[model samples]
Target: MSHSIEITPIDDQCPLLHQTKKDNIEEAGKINGQYTNKSANHIIDEKLKDLDKYTSKKFIAIFKVNVGLRKSNPDAYTPMLISIGPYHKKNPQLGSMEKYKLMYLRRFLQRKRGLDVEHCITEIEKLKGIALKCYDDIENLDNDIVDKFSEILLLDGCFVVEFIRECSGMKPNREDKIISTNCMINLVLRDLLLLENQLPFFVLTKLQYMTKEVDEVPITKLVKETFFSILPKMAHASYLEREGDVKCIKHLLQLVHMSSHPSYYNSLWHVQDLSLKIISKDQDYQTWHANMPNVTELCEAGVRFSKVGNTYSDLEDRTTLFDIKFENGRMRMPCFEVDDVTETLLRNLIAYEQQTCDVLPKHFSDFAVFMDYLID
Candidate 1:
């Protein structure tokens, strides 16, 4: 009985079993395909809905420093002692300056007798939405109610106006800590120049008009004198002198930008000239890596260095910082001064120009790229 047992293979006995298995697999694949198609369609519909709801507006100008730039020098992009806008409003390290802001606000209000704090808050409230739109991330701003946002705008705006006024030789009231402390004032100045720590230009302008004295100096003049005083005497003298109207400025950083290149702000001749020169010469403007020699190498190659008048000179012959000439193996360039605040200052200006300016000549970004070529 044990030797008589024989078993046939299932495939040989019933070939239909293999066909049925194949059919089941194909059916499962078809169902999965339908499900995948439905999912893709749903995703496309959602994206279309988002596109339809999107509205174009110029609400963001100030941006967080790019990670690459920030990684190079974190302190250059950070606000150490003070916060100006919604971006850094909640930074605990900057919390100490809140009291100083209030102190400045009090002095600001006292400038005009019988000017209620509520009045300033109300004025800021009127432009609150527009002001908020001028920032990149507004979740922190929107999370707060109107009252809180208005107070912040009013306080920060007035503090900046008063600080600039005080720095411009308008004696502060009763030895103000911010004005009296040299180290603190320097920190505040650096903080103000930060890209993230900024308010809308219109907000500052509105505050200026409200608190302007009968014979007070213009706000632009005061700001230029106050902020640029820290640099060398000739740092921004020519540019500041040439600037006419600053009402079109967008922020503190933009003000610095215009102060740096007055000719660019007033006219596009320099930009056109640069574009033509680069295009005609077939220079590698697109890539940072080129056959550019560094300062040391150029010196060893029998190139003599002579200092030009200004980094931002508007002479018809020389228009930009990159207007270097190597005539007869001698190089003539505008003297560029580098200092502790230079990186922070330049980084903020570049960020502002890249984000806010509508014009084609991104002079700051272009200059940065040019510098990178030399350094690399």
Candidate 2:
């Protein structure tokens, strides 16, 4: 006799599964290095010294951002978390995020052998100032891609694109923040915001100090050229942005994801400088795409968009992203597939961030309880 039985799937809505709404801030925080490690600072300083032999100011932002993320009271929706990359633990069961967080936090806040601890006060001060400023800018932070793009533009010749590809891939917590290829992408972009301009100097100092950190030839040479260059362009880019030249603004914003070498960066730059020159008007990509069938690769990074109450004016010329573009009088968009850990965290952060931005007085009792439990 043969028997057939049906296998029942777990319901996401089941309370036993806790559903996604049960905010796990404490758990996430615990993984994000919320615990105290007494000897943490000394080890961090040593790590910083070792890294400095390879690069200067490299660990500054690494530490600054690392500490910023660490020091941030999780109550603020400013919960943009960062830590070691997915590759850190080949096996999750054997590897512990707790140890990783301890080291990561220590590295950011300590000063060891390589540092002229007495004379290094000024350099540390500079990092603190910039980091504090960024925190202040949080309220004014534009969620639109253009601001990010424009910020990149203020740097030299697609250098950010080059630098990011080289440095990124960190996560604070091991257990829940799911690692993916996209995480790598965000890692590069976010870190670039901190270390982009300083990359070239960082490279030279790093190479002289630690010869075997990585082995990429052309990338090394290119970094040398960019670090030495890029200063003059910042002035011109600043001028264009202040004028609200939509084309120039959008073009620069797109550059965050591009570089002088990348085709996308080249394509986007061409569209911004020469394309408008040819069109003889402040025409956006919407007007250009109507006549041109192909989308330039560069424009992908900077995009024109409208959300709730804001307009990314710099991204005006990017035209609607093809996904959001219309075809044959119909519209299409990627399915918002839920049920992933990162996606869930992103949604949670987005919702919390939105609430904070929208109201001065926001509730955090539940969030606090959740976060406290995780850290405790």
Candidate 3:
């Protein structure tokens, strides 16, 4: 004999089933009430906590390059020889230079008879609040960050101050390894200009004042003499001389950026307006997809290319490296010597403009995009 089992389905009014449903509903209600009981301001505060960290007035200019921009050329944004600031302080490749930094720090403290490492540390520690705010990613630091950060500011600040001094002809030691050879000096300069490898200008300035080194010379003058000697001129001589307000400069990279900015504001505006005309009103200016005709195409269509010559003759009447113009079927552009140094500098400048798009005009990026169109 075969037996078959009969199944009974759950009924709508089953007491156990009703109790389970009621329990789930009550638990969900409790969870919902926890949120609903919050005041509107409390809800908003919770929502805006992350935004507040970034948008606060205390936040300053230094920022990490966005990953999308950085991934294209990782080496372009990284320091090769020496690390500066807290961003790359722990980079293993940069570890070899820490000894040299310490040596420089020793030399820095010796500049004044009464100056000592303890005093320097104490003074820098005082500026900790201001210095810390100048960089991004401070929240991700470890528990002992206060001590670590203060130490970095001291060493890096001393290294920069001394390095600039040595470069400015202040009688560097004959055996100094960093500036001992031309290759090393160039590498150090390249490393210093990387956006991530920078301390706030104020930290260096304060260190200088504390030691009373180069008291007569402004830090800007020392920087110009040191940095400009190695970097090829990307702007007119007058533009290089037109220093940004020293008080406003954030770091070495920014100072160089400001010095190289094109002086032809009217031309920049005209170019920007021309770009605006090409895009539909609904499209974003940044996302406008139009590209100018390449050089070959323009040449095929009866355009002439000429290099702007004799720019150094009269600095007062010179156009900047970025001042490209087209008129009467002739295209004139400032000549640029393309090489390793130039590429490195341009790449970093473009990266800076890309990362700081909100606060800064895209002068470098626009110049690069124009170049891209011309080249290909």
Candidate 4:
């Protein structure tokens, strides 16, 4: 007896499989159609709705050091002793300075005589919105955030004002531990110059005007002297003594940058067109050449180095660090001493110019690029 078994095709046996696939395809088509039919104008309108909430005034000047740069040298960018602004205010390592800030605040109030602590809080509150706007990462800080921020501004601003006053020889508080010790003062100065450690210039100016006597040295002069005194010997000589009043400085680091290149800050030297000048319009491309060798290679090529005898005052009008002169096969350049503070100072200056964009010229950035090319 022979028996035969019949096998049906999968599709024929299971008709629902085809229907399920067809349903899936139709649903996918509907989703794709919805995406494709979105009009450009409608999409733009939806985007514009978010723009109003994020449309900020250009109050943000200070910025955290970018990750790329910070990765190589984290210590250069981080504050060790104290935090000045909202960015690093919560670091546990810097908590010790908070008490000193309060102490400075009390002294500041004493200097003002009748000005109560509430008055300081109120004044800071008035500018709290504007001050908060000065930071880029304060989006989460709502109007209710004003109270905490106001307290920070009050304490930090008073600390800075008092420190500057003491540094400038206004009156020394012998009992104060921070300003009294030379090492502590130096550390504080370094911390204050960090890129993230900054307060708005106007805030410090307001505090200075409120507390300072009519006959006292202006805050600008005091700041200039204090900063110059703390910098290394080479940077001290590099400072170009300004004749007139100081320009509107944004922070202590800005003051350092301006002091280093006064002509550029004072508008005496405008941004030079750094582009290679075209000799003729007919020339499609300009030939560029730079053979900057290392000191060893340059020595082998019969080049000699000599210290530039010209003082900072002698070359006050020049705007670049590349103020070199080649005479008799010897390259004469200004002497610059690089010490512990040099790296931190330079990194902050470059960070400032990088973030400020249109607010200040990119002198430091240009210098860094120039140096990189030479090193390469």
Candidate 5:
């Protein structure tokens, strides 16, 4: 097994030491104190350089300590070998869907081999006790702040339901598979109440961009400028299939549609950093994405999801094995078929699409002419 410096009987305890050592991150924070816009970029750049130096130094120190420890006791390193690969997140953007789906499948199977969907899906459920304050606030009334809290609920809930619905029907080869990233992401969002406090906007921003960056850049800062507030509204569209929620969904969408977003593109620093990522991680990603066979490449990595017991058969007829509240409020099957649900949902969506088509032409003569041409 490979050895490192951090394992040596150090002056610090391992876990606490690990956390303490992490204070010297390779990624830099935004420099405090005001500066002109031009100077801000340069300042950010210099800080990033310093952060990288600190991170490298820490890595060297840790390596030296670990190598010394392995020489002392090789048995200790074995546990670490089992912990290989990233536990949280490794990269920023979720790469090509095909590769991610395959990777997800592999991980799932490895983690939960031979587990049926019923047993596998159980971890996603069960009580993880709520924030008592957040829970209590929801139980009894606060008339004055009810509107604000309600607004948050509407935003958060809508984002989740729609994301699930939109992603509920993914499969490989069909070009209509569930996005594994979306599923994992949504679960993480739900588990926030279970795991952490209600995720603040900045934390949410960090989670999106928190993949280890090339120069040890913490994405949370960039995420501050990168996020679209209206992103929360996409959830409303998803739960449209659920009953009695149509008007609420429409109102949420209307707010999103009317909103203006902050100019985040300027804060982005892709000029060099993005390239560093592309050169590094993209090679592995490109290799995986390119490996797809033309025939089966586009499907949900053939559903052979390692962890979730998903197979092409599992995804057959477009079904996924989510413990979802079906449109009728009953629990959908542990492994429900997708095509049946989509045909029904798509029919309603298409009908709505037609109504939209009918109405949009009144405001746009070009649209009216285009509709006429299509009918002709």
Candidate 6:
């Protein structure tokens, strides 16, 4: 006969386990916390007092990209020409653009012929709490936090507003550096849309309202004009204006994502189940859940592909980037033109969709997965 002996678990507070808070308590005492006997629960509560700041909904929008995702391609998410917001404000490489920010700020102040710079600064200061809460990694910044953050928002916000206004129609000075050069304009446009290079949209709106011309056009109108001028020819101003004005734009990238959202997908797919059933020539029950046949396989099976016309006014009520339809052995898709910045645009968009998946439907992610399935 054999007997089993049960092993008892050791306490988390046991000194032998080397998990007790004694050392921490001694360190705290050395820092002048005075002597006291604190329970484990109390200690843990103290340590996690600021936990809710991170978990709150107010702070959920902006975040650093996941390490796994960033490691895949750091350059895709990093800003190239100029940095915006607190995350990249300290990068030495972007220092060259700082002078332009101040220049724009001076121009913005001078535009209204008595626009108080202090008034703009005070307004940005009021938003410090809300702005700080939007960023997840802002706490990592070193000293002079208040002044540094306020200055960043003030400078970057003014620069973006002025840049957009100039791009829209405001004639720049004859010697304007960025606006005069097409190459620099394109680079700055790309930089503004990076995931890590962003400021909360409200900040921009506030600055625009504070310094807008007496009969200034709507900010949305200005944004569309600027984006339309630089966006790829395939996806022009009409494409970005599909959804009209969005009510809850988080940032520039999010604005672009919203504008590029496919209305066709919105009408057909179910959010609860992110899969759709597509009837193939061989099978009627084929869903996106399975390993679907590739494009070549479908073509070999007697499927014909055609490019849909770009003008959506004649076809449907709305235009979409991912407009594809299959019927009567024919697959019709909207023409997509790939340029140099296309990959960077799509990568940042996919990153945004992945990060905000909890609050946002995975439009770009679904499109990417579908494209992968078709190509692979």
TM-score of each: 0.75, 0.23, 0.79, 0.74, 0.16, 0.79
Model 6: residues with Cα > 4 Å off, grouped in runs: 1-42, 53-55, 172-178, 229-247, 263-287, 310-319, 358-360
Candidate 3 lDDT, tens digit per residue, 1-376? 9999976675643443234575365455455563334355576888788775553444566777778877878888888889888888778988988888998888887777888888887898888888888877776766575468888899988999888888877744464544578887888899898877889998988987776644448777788777765554454464447474677878888887777656565445334443333333465556644644677877897878898744342334455666676666788777645556677778887777666645355677777777776787
* Candidate 4 C-alpha lDDT tens digits along 67-144: 877887889989889899888876899999999998888888888668999898888888777777777766644554
Scored against the true structure, residue 292 in model 1 reaches a CA lDDT of 54
RMSD of each: 9.8, 22.7, 7.8, 9.3, 28.5, 6.4
Candidates, ranked, lDDT? 3, 6, 1, 4, 2, 5
Candidate 5 lDDT over 1-376, as tens digits, reads 9977756565553343245445433231223233555667887999887664232221110011134333544332221101111111122332232243344433333333374334322422221111112222222335343334432332333233223223333122343433446445433322221111122232122222222224433222222112221122112222221233222222111212222111122332221232223233444533432232221321233312122223233112222222112122121222323431222222222222233323221212222222233233
Candidate 1, residue 240: CA error in Å? 2.0
Considering lDDT, which of the candidate structures 3 and 5 is the better prediction for this target? 3
CA deviation > 4 Å runs, candidate 1: 1-57, 140-142, 145-147, 172-178, 231-237, 242-245, 262-289, 309-324, 357-360
TM-score of 5: 0.16
lDDT of 4 at 216: 86
* Model 2 poorest 10 in a row by lDDT: 249-258
Q: TM-score of model 3 relative to the true fold?
A: 0.79
Clashing pairs in 3: none
Candidates' lDDT values, in order?
0.69, 0.29, 0.72, 0.68, 0.27, 0.70
Of 3 and 4, the candidate ranking higher by TM-score = 3
**Model 2 ranges with Cα > 4 A deviation:** 1-99, 104-122, 137-322, 342-376
- Estimate the overall C-alpha local distance difference test score of candidate 5: 0.27
TM-score, candidate number 4: 0.74
Off by over 4 Å in 4: 1-48, 55-57, 140-147, 172-178, 232-247, 262-291, 309-323, 359-361, 370-376
Error of model 5, residue 10, in angstroms: 83
CA displacement after TM-score superposition, residue 255 of candidate 6 (Å): 1.7
